[model samples]
Target: MDGVTVIDHPLVQHKLTIMRKKETSTAGFRRLLREISMLLCYEVTRDLELTMETIETPLVEMQAPIVEGKKLVFASILRAGNGLLEGMLELVPSARVSHIGVYRDHETLQPVEYYFKAPEDIAERLIIIVDPMLATGNSSIAAVDKLKERGAHNIRFLCLLAAPEGIKNFQSVHPDVKIYTASIDSHLNELGYIVPGLGDAGDRMYGTK
Candidate 1:
């Protein structure tokens, strides 16, 4: 867990509990995810470098701090990752957006990419990959692998809930990328769902089967 940071803020914990409940409605679940995404954005960008700039207030001239470099890129992991994307954009409206669609191949238990689109200069921007669940880590790993192949060097992974096995597998393969999650749930079940996880995140958010 060296590179993993759990967002344990009181508000974050309370919101996550509401999200985990079996009875939460789709509208309510989506609202909570947006709010939580804003909160998580605060922590993840805490250490971003800033540079001082000359500026003028209404009455006088002064220097101000601004984030360094071009806007960041949020690489969402397909359908579910878009849930988190909605809120992160609230904080950084100018940041670039990328989408990666990957699904697990049941028989081989491996990740297969179906879609991928991103900024041409992906190698030059910091990328934050958002996905709701990190169950087996196969998809996350595969997504990161694809990004690295495209020349992305600085990358991070964020999720709402994760399992220890998933985290271990992710870190073992991508140790340089830090992981941020709200909760580390119990182990995954035989079918690959994280035990006690908030069900399928995409399904719950969309009220789909």
Candidate 2:
């Protein structure tokens, strides 16, 4: 798909394997999510525009490359997205952070927006929405919808793991938004969880289970 980038880098694949194991500990899972997020950020930001500038490097004045245009905005789909946000921020420290809160309704199977707050100049910046799991893709879609409503035009979605069904649904709805993921699994289970998935990312990250 034009908008989908499956990150199969060795480090990403290795960490994903550890994350998929049933025996992975809570702390280990949390740490792996951060490490993988950093790797994903590298792939996601690969095409970022850079411009050369003259700078002095102690001995001589030389041209150095610097990021061009507006800084990126990292919009996290809480609270699972928070886990990935830390690592992404480490790589793009100057990137602004935004929060989009959405929860899946158990009865209706729909996303409910509880809280959504983004940068004022979202339309002028590239916004990367982070979430660990993309099973049903309800929340991610809704998050993007909200961002668009708030005038965000350039946006991308990043995740650690995703299901085929979720990817299809997301692509069908928002074909223009690029999606980057570490792994793509089979399908969502009967209970709407991604099969062979790393379980509930929020719970595993916080040790709430």
* Each prediction's TM-score versus the true structure: 0.97, 0.97
- Give a tens-digit lDDT track for model 1, residues 1-209: 69999999999999999999999999999999999999998888888999999999999999899999878999999889999999999999999999999987767767889999999999999999999999999999999999999999999999999999999999999999999999999898887889899999999989997
How far residue 73's Cα lies from its native spot in candidate 2, in Å, is: 0.3
lDDT of 2 by residue, 1-209 (tens): 56779999999999999988888999999899899999999999999999999999989999999999999999999899999999999989999999999987866768999998888999999999999988888889999999999999999999988899899888888888999998888888888889888888998899998
Model 2 root-mean-square deviation? 1.0
Q: List the residue pairs that clash in candidate 2.
A: none
Please report how far candidate 2 places residue 21 from its true position, in Å. Answer: 1.4
Q: What overall lDDT goes with each candidate model?
A: 0.93, 0.91
